[model samples]
Target: MEIDYSQIKVIGFDADDTLWVNETYFRDAEIAFGKLLSEYETINKIDQELFKMEMQNLGIYGYGVKAFMLSMVESAMEISNNNVSIKTIQAILDIGKDMINKPVELLDGVETVLSTLSKKYRLILATKGDLLDQERKLEKSGLTDYFHHIEVLSDKKEKNYSRLLNHLDIKPSEFLMIGNSLKSDVLPLINIKAHAIHVPFHTTWAHEQVTEKETNGKAYKTLSSLKEVLNLIH
Candidate 1:
């Protein structure tokens, strides 16, 4: 089926994996965390429990490394029966700090794509994460000037997207979202009658993974690279 972008005046980009390296760091941190708690349980068990903890804590901690670090701490304590040492807890904090401090590495053709699209359309950043952390990354990325507006959302759901579009005075049909997460960036926008393009990253957080049933009959474009987006939009 053919999709139309002729009415799309505003384009929104997801920050994390869509524009730069993000989920990869979380994977690395998870591995380190597993090693730290290896004495309490097997690596596989630790990984599973940590993911469970993260899901349970999402509403409380929201998203970003700080939330993840707290989940790690909670999981460590639970798996160790509250016998985990302070040094290990400190190690978890250090892991998150290291992740936050890691340099932002933009994906291939990100700048070029943003630059090209900005010239032709209204580009806005619509990403969800810790405001300070997301702001820090945007500053570090050096791609801030390309966007007309930057929104760090608390969450990315149909309602959130609708609210954002309404605030921007944009109709759903006039907005397009580009991101890596099918759950956050693609499905929500599609639900609100907006256009979305999925650009999958190599590693994805378990929370962001969506089942086939959720995406059944969904109409969206999936491109292998950001460069391919130029073909779709204009």
Candidate 2:
């Protein structure tokens, strides 16, 4: 079913995989680290241990390159019997820096969709991540101008979403949340009775993936690509 954009006064978007290639970069880094860890253990073992570290750290550090880099260092030490050297530490940090330094690659149809939708509705970039990292990416992507406000937050829980709704002076029905991660973007907004559009992305980061069993009905509508949103808007 196509949603009517006439009532959607504000459109909030999740920054990473929704608009640009995000988790793929982190996955590349993880695969690189897996190769490094393979020198000491089996590839499967490395994957299991890294996944464990990621789960443990997500509760502590949340998400971003910093948590990911530290998780890598800790995983290397644990798997290698605490034999981590300066080189290993440097290698982990290097991967983190690589992700930060990587060129921002806007996903297919993002520019066209955003540029088209911006003309009608108030566009807001609502993303959660490391502040500096997200800000740098927004500047580099050259798509920043389309947004009237950009929220760089460490978390996108119900409280933050509510605050943003109030800050924009918009009701839940008047806004639509467009994002990839159902856990971070869809669930919280749904809790507040907000409408959301889900654009399922390929290559989800380990931490952000939500299995089918967790989804709620009536809260979100999944789309194949963002271009669909443009079609809905205009």
Q: Which one wins on lDDT? A: 1
Candidate 2 C-alpha lDDT tens digits along 1-234: 555546778999998988888888887887899888777998888888988998898878877888888889999999999887788779888999999899998988999888888988889999987888889999999998999999987788889999989988999888889999888888888789787888988877666777777783544678899898776666
Give the per-residue Cα lDDT of candidate 2 at 94: 96
Candidate 2: segments with Cα more than 4 A from true spot: 1-5
Per residue, candidate 1 scores C-alpha lDDT tens digits across 107-214 of: 999999998999989999999989999999999999999999999999999999999999999999999999999999999999999999999998888889999999
Q: Compared to the true structure, candidate 2 yields what TM-score?
A: 0.93
Any runs in candidate 1 off by more than 4 Å, and if so which? none
lDDT of each: 0.95, 0.85
Model 2 accuracy (lDDT, Cα) = 0.85
TM-score winner among the candidates? 1
Please give me the total number of clashing residue pairs in predicted model 2: 0
